[model samples]
Target chain A: MSTEIATGRDIALIDLLDRLLHGGVVLAGDITLAVADIDLVYVGLRALISSVATAEENGVPLP
Target chain B: MPEADDARLARLKALLAASAAEDAAALLAEARDAAREEARSILQDVWREALLEAAAAAVEPRPPPERRRVRQEEGTAVVEPQPPEPRSVPQEGTAAVGPRPTEPRSVPQEGTAWWAYCVVPAAEADRVPPNLDSVDPSGPVEIVTCGELAAVVSRVPLSEYGDERLREHLEDLAWVERVARAHEEVLEAAMSATTIVPLRLCTIYLSRDRVEALLEDQAPGLAAALAELRGRTEWGVKVFAPAAAVAASASTEVAGGSAYIERKRSERAAREEAHQRTNECAQDVHARLEREAVAACVNPPQRREAHGRDAQMLLNGSYLFDDERRSVLESIVEALAGEYEPLGFSIELTGPWPPYNFVLPSASALS
Candidate 1:
């Protein structure tokens, strides 16, 4: 367990974009939405598994 | 036989508990009833506030000519053209985009309406016609706009899984997929124009008025937000390292050896040391790359069982950059490839996606 603060600037723009694009205040509106019959969890899991599998199959080396 | 019977009983008990606990039908019924009551309460609380805020807020009177739009070109649907007037500053940016040319109206939902939304600027409000792209686009896209805020409402309800009867028969994986797709559609539509504020899954608004009021309440903040987000786009970059290759590199980097046993042990230690160093290198690469980009976010890297591949995912990163700098960013990534080639790691960048993670509540709404 190393307690350290790395002090070197000059970070990449992509990294900044990642935070600016994906990180923020999520406003969950007070509205109930009807969604399709399929499940979101399964979709995510399946996508994850298949993408990994595809990577392996395509020789991309799954991590 | 007795042990097996006990296990079966335990399974049954678990099933019974789930039925009582998370039954979708009961939850939906409860939520449905609650939404109705909550809707009324929200209306009551905000109705007065809405009127007061709209009056106090800077409600620019319509500049008549800016309201008329050039019709969509033949066969090519286009988002709103650049605001007819040019303004360099923030306050002026508000005037540049202007207000919704027409008042928003509600279309009735036949059965249950599930709210699906991807946030777009109020300027692109007209592009999302009501009931436009519902699973069956047979109807108009149920669009409701307020100032610079727009939500493409869908009447399709997500299937309830909490009901014991249906839960037993339901394919949960299938249900989530359908909902995600609905989310995707709205998000895709939003991405086509400006950075969209993606609403969470299964959010439903009972009436169009609430959305209008919401827009009214959040307008000033949303307007400023639109100005901030107008020109930028998002991209993703993930860095992965092959575990086997890392291990191999480690073994090959062994230092001096004396006795056979000591030498063999030293080789193993050397491999572990090299592996740790490689992991560190991978992290540095991602962190440095992110720091160099315009804006970047590093999400928790997901770990899974090694899939007989030589790689370990060291970083999963998303980036937001302006279009002009897309190539500049890509070049930086290419440069990283050259630098980290010796470490047996690779950086994969994918995107130009909607700013799904960057949606913020209008700041004025907070004040």
Candidate 2:
């Protein structure tokens, strides 16, 4: 078994979307546009209402 | 295989059509183990802090109510009576405008950009098998090596991914799903090959030279992150309490008080006590899981609309620990679930995911 439990039935993709879009290393500045560079859109789309404050508080450029 | 197994295989095949058969079989087996008879397909089964402060701060954490309101009724952002900061929510009014990039953006309006997916040591870069598809398949997935750092990239056409274009694409749920799936498929393939430091989705550079510069500039920090994150995996533990169950738990025997004042007071106090108890259950669970995790993060609970559930979330937590302890951690969560079931609490364990939660935004944490 894959050391994982059954969770997020329909929403696993949602969680994956959250991580793909928000989680992972941020190449902050310099050079071209990192997703992080131009993320206010995606951040606002899926996470605006729910996670903006947490993102702001954590300073993670998320949401 | 049994008929049930065959049915599951069919479902997996339908939900994901591109996975290699071997992977499907393997995930099928795991999904079988995770079978909770919930009548849903979840192969997509896809952190923390200082002990005291984080746990304390996470209880019922609420941002400004205005900020919490989405395009419900009014797409207008609430102007703070006193205004905390001038941080504007761009296109806040256009949220419900339906899958259209409404944000105003100013930058790079021409030429293609290399969308970087993840980085691995140059030594293992060759192992990141090619031929895999990416967010945009304008070019084959390739690697750019700078010293010991290697970036996995796909050359994307700028017309479809430019600042304004991409913002519009992000608004389209169908579009984001397709792109997100493609993005994750690349990382998952790389992961199977070697340890990787995943770049946030949509990391793009103007040219190969810019990508190389990134490898050079972030080398030490990146290397440190790779070293620190080498074998660890991120697992999520979410505790949910169905509304009815929690409500029943909150209601107490009203002491047969015939007096209206007495019954009213008791009922209100009972609800207050129940709310406090729920918070305690959450913190108690977090403390227990924290002991076993090298790092932990308590995320804001996913709203009911977002999760598509009728239950109230007690905890939405992520924990990172040695991969070898995966089964052990699973057991701990299963046991915890049973322990809290009586109080209307249910815990779920899902993981073996790429270490997304562990990547410190500032890799300097390693330095």
Query: For model 1, how many clashes?
Result: 70
Docking class of 2: incorrect
CA RMSD (A), model 1:
23.2
Query: Model 2 Cα displacement at B204 (Å)?
Result: 1.0
Q: Which stretches of candidate 1 lie over 4 Å from their true place?
A: A1-25, A31-63, B1-110, B128-132, B135-140, B158-171, B245-264, B305-310, B360-367
lDDT of 2 by residue, B1-367 (tens): 8999999999998767666776889989767644531121121110111222233346535443211211112211111111112212334444221121113333365787788888898999998877988787688899999998899998888778765676567666667777777777777778767778877666667678878877886787788767766666777788776464344332333443246335545544655555566667788777787778766766667655466555767677777776777667877787787788876777777666666666644322212
**Interface RMSD in Å per candidate, to 1 decimal?**
16.2, 10.1
DockQ of 2: 0.15
**Residue-by-residue lDDT tens digits, candidate 1, B1-367:** 6999999999999999999777877989878865664464356335433432222221122223212111112321112212122312222322211111123322232434435465567677666533335532333456677766776665543233112212222234444444445445555555554555555444444446756665565555445555555665656666665454334322332333235336545544654555565556556665666565555544544343322234655566555566667667788888888877656666776655555444432211222
User: All candidates' TM-scores?
Assistant: 0.53, 0.64
